[model samples]
Target chain A: MPFEEKFHLRIPGPTPVPLRVQHAMNRPMIGHRSAECSRLVQKCSQRLQSVFGTRENVLIIAGSGTSALEAAVANTVAPGEEAVVVVTGAFGDRFAKIADRFGARVHRLDIPWGEACSPDALKSFLLSRPRVKAVFLTHCETSTGVLNPVRDLAQIVREHSDALVIVDGVSSVGGVPCEMDAWGIDIFVTGSQKALMLPPGLAFVAVGPRARKVIRQAEAPRFYLDLQAYQEQLEKETTPFTPAIAHLFGLEAALDMLDEEGLENVFARHRLMMEMTRAGIRALGLPLLAEDAVASPTVTAVRGTETIDATALQKELRRIGVVVASGQQHLKGKIFRIGHMGYCDPLDVLTLLSATETALHRLGKPVRWGAAVAAAEEVWSRV
Target chain B: MPFEEKFHLRIPGPTPVPLRVQHAMNRPMIGHRSAECSRLVQKCSQRLQSVFGTRENVLIIAGSGTSALEAAVANTVAPGEEAVVVVTGAFGDRFAKIADRFGARVHRLDIPWGEACSPDALKSFLLSRPRVKAVFLTHCETSTGVLNPVRDLAQIVREHSDALVIVDGVSSVGGVPCEMDAWGIDIFVTGSQKALMLPPGLAFVAVGPRARKVIRQAEAPRFYLDLQAYQEQLEKETTPFTPAIAHLFGLEAALDMLDEEGLENVFARHRLMMEMTRAGIRALGLPLLAEDAVASPTVTAVRGTETIDATALQKELRRIGVVVASGQQHLKGKIFRIGHMGYCDPLDVLTLLSATETALHRLGKPVRWGAAVAAAEEVWSRV
Candidate 1:
């Protein structure tokens, strides 16, 4: 059998899509320039505003999440302009690297792997470098499972400098409570595959007025990701180029599901899953990479013991029909991650903990059978 | 009812996807880093090579066709380098504009709207400018429905100068005969929605040795559409960023269908459709935008008479449960297009021509009923 039909996917992004969204992909193609297509695009853009928690329209691009991040950077900071990027993990480093590629003079503020960036440090940096044009932040870093304090960091940037606060909410947005306007975020970028319960194709970015002003004046070299062109086309309820029509269909269905469930309830469910998973891991005598206060609601990263190899654990779980993500880049084989972001419930968390317990026991590690699942169930029942 | 369920998509791109490919997209999401996902990606890359007519693997990006075009320019031409772009229509002008955005000193070789670029003109230009780093050509101009002689143009570039010949086969590749290795084309880019019988999210590019050499040394700013990172990740049978996994499933099914029918038969089918469409238009006393000798096999552009407005004709056709594309940019309301590529067949051509006749008659234009369909059926029966 194909792995897609049998394996339980628990990767951070590219999360398991719901059946309704998958079925939505079967909708036939439409003429993109037709009036019907324009109406469909217009409706999708309006619905996306609610999820983004912004009054402004979100710019949708037919690309991966990285392209959206690049667009946010390319549209705001011109070449030789200064920007501060807080690097807490691999994805934070990616944000900084993208800015660097666009000829921005990036100032890397490095935080430890499993820790979030301090807002006071950012304030001091902004106070010293008042000429910085933008401050890049990652709401949730998938590599270390750390949820940075974006609201506090954005507030500090607003108080100390005129820099735009750009947030990479790729792994967090729909799962966590990210109020873009309330947080003073000038540019917020997210992917469709995470808590959106869709496949990995379309990316969304909500640009505020300050970022729009910078976009008009920025001399960045861009064509496919030009925000001004997208803005102009948005008025006509279409994109400048052919978009992913099937993905847009799926987005409509997914957004309907999100709206039906209520955004606050969805966030609460994610928070419950995170607590249950962490409780289960602790009961299994495993240490989480991120501290409790900064742990991400989307994914949980657990550090491996001396006897446990992360890749081996992943493969062992795969044999038992569960799929999880391993550490990325420098942390490979040292940590493992379990994602419970989209379309996940209490029962799903119990299954993941049960599978981990079995895999650890089969690998000759000292694991108490049923302890992890029982602990998760206790947290679940209370929630 | 939604237009997706009933509309006959006759646009130049975002073409009609086959039922099998659409069904394939319903497959459940798998972990992108899993072994199964790796196998799927490797198989896709190999099958794409057969369609691209290249010995090397094709680079697949999770973006629109324009993103693939940007990658071609960003990888080969550095800032301050000289390049030549052949502009015959909107997409051609887009290619030149992207190079200019990347700071390349672009030499625009402007051809007439409805005419193909002559190889002799390109040869003379190349001889005069020996320092030209790259030459961009559009294989099929979807705007004017003209097909350029890319093989001959690449041969001239190889003989006269050391410039790399890059071809945009966006609307042509699978429906037309474009042998990348045999023609000495350095880079060939295409989209999934046109002839690949899939949705519009994925873009494919087949790179030759000469272009790879230049890409290694090119200093153009890029991160998401970076070819070097893609090349490195291709070794691991994966992409640098998350790809459109649902499209990959659809692509596998579509490629299987193409292989079952054979590529030669696919090209022959497109040719037959083109002949039938042209014969039908001529029988209805409609002039074609492109001359017969240079007409494209994928799409047909027809000039509208003063009695008939192109957009109104398109809207009238839509009311009768068919959808056709009107001319783009300055040609809007002057000409209309009919796309008969990918999953289209002889019967589809007959239906399109019949609808055109009905739309023209309803608009009070003098058109003979059944004459156009009979002309198309004559060509179809002969085929």
Candidate 2:
């Protein structure tokens, strides 16, 4: 079978893994209970603190970002408790759903799909819901390519109510700026498949001391996704369950790559790619779902015009070995998302813009031969 | 850094992953929502049916074996519901704990740590509990290296109560005989490690029609581990959440390898290795924890004598590049387990035996010379 080395993957997640991370994950398997694995787990957990921008030892769960979100919810909210979810996009709705499923009395604070939840709006929402146990917020609304002002919102949640401030940074943590402690984030979660530059399997949760104490006393019914067991085991440099061992190996390499690149540089690169992608998309005469003020550095959603269908454009891009994400849920056929997170660069953005131009030309839409690429090049030059 | 090519991975789970599978996992990443990934997930689920010896498509989750076990419990037992957990070893205790945490009326029928629950005992125990909702049983207890009589015990459960027969085949699925449908198993779960010849992370669960019905009505609070959502998305050839893409690639390769060497042949190879390891250990004057009649084909637990310390032997073997499992929980210093499943052959067992001899000598034990090797050679020749 042929390999996918040449294919350009621009999806919001399950992003392209670097060859180095792949090789790291391909190393020979070691015993999970062996001293070698124990040391590796301990080191990875410690290093992940730098990525999450927290002093707490991050707890790794062998599951998806959704699993991490569930861990945050399950550990903090019990049945009949109140949780306020800031529903900015699909992922916010997902958090709300999990809260409801766990029997929490959920109050969803809805914003426009591509809009960010302002701190004033959150403060007003939390004013009446004085008995809230936790407030779930999304750092990057992946489904709509919007980045919420999480630090500001978390600060508001802390002052207005007694709710724990939990943030989902799945698609933004490493690529976007996240200062968990300074932001007063009680619980922070991310996944390996997003900006972490690895396959989807492992979920990392960074919890503050207060959150850990709350998790211990929380009455939410849980077993596998419980955060308390993970913390206890993590204190001993092991996991409650057998971890995704190979992913941890890949994570070590990915973390080292991020360290070498420097956290500030990584965030800058993501911002540059997002700027380039948005500029190119705008030049192509297509509308963007998110505004510049709320645009995500990790992903950007572009809307289709009457002349060009988003679904058709996605299909055309895939046919040309460039894959992008189509609109999800109610926005189907309306927008397509381009991922500029982990393993992506200016060159990748240029390639996607070039492919979009070609796909548009093939769809009978008039396009200046290199208008999108030229716009992307202008951003590259300015940066 | 030097590779671990010569090291013997002798743990029960997190078994040695084959080089071919490792290379397969190193392939470039693809969009998880793309048609390619959809096809991959569908094909792997279908192919897994053969390994599980079931007609139902196995639903894969992005987590460890423990997560799969938790899924089974959380999806079937509601709060205040009755469930029977047959506790034969550590894993069985884990199942009971999960059930208990889920607020089920958990009845743990405890057997000796190193012994399997007898069919007669289970039959009589179930007779008094007519309202049992499910029975959790381990096919192979890795802690004690005992293979339970799942088929017979499941048959008895089917006859006596209306309880669903749930089996944990984490360390046995690809290397042991598990006729799920024939044995009347309602729900069966396993993980990517162990006999699957891959690093840990992905969990596979296969459910019968009856089990699905009960799970749909189950009142246990869950979101990430909700199997119903997984089943619905699986019907559309996708997952409810992001899957471990690289592990799925490795799983496809592992399944192909299993197909090449038929499932029966794979089981035979594991049995051969188990026999060889057990013979060598007995010849070295070590006592076997599990009786020969109930010994696991994938792993063998050998107890240390007064003159030999299991902990010291494990340390010495590791110094010589051999890794084995120490007894867990209460048996921490009494026994050492040698894994013989997944990528292990008679040669690997013989190499381990030689290392054991050397370690024993280093630890001031009597010189066995070539006694262990000779015994292993005799077993290898007979096989």
Candidate 1: tens digits of C-alpha lDDT, residues B331-361: 9888889898999999898998898899888
Best by DockQ: 1
**lDDT by residue for model 2 (A119-202), tens:** 999999999989999999999999999999998999999888878999999998889989999989999999999899999999
Once model 2 is optimally superposed onto the true structure by TM-score, how far is the C-alpha of residue A281 displaced, in angstroms?
1.0
What is each candidate's DockQ, to 2 decimals?
0.85, 0.83
Instruction: Give residue B113's lDDT in candidate 1 (0 to 100).
Output: 87
Q: Which ten residues in a row have the lowest lDDT in candidate 1 chain A?
A: A1-10
Q: What's the lDDT of the predicted structure labeled candidate 1?
A: 0.90
lDDT by residue for model 1 (A121-189), tens: 888877888789999999999899999999999999998888899999999988999889998999999
- For model 1 the local lDDT of residue A183 reads 88
Pick the lDDT winner: 2
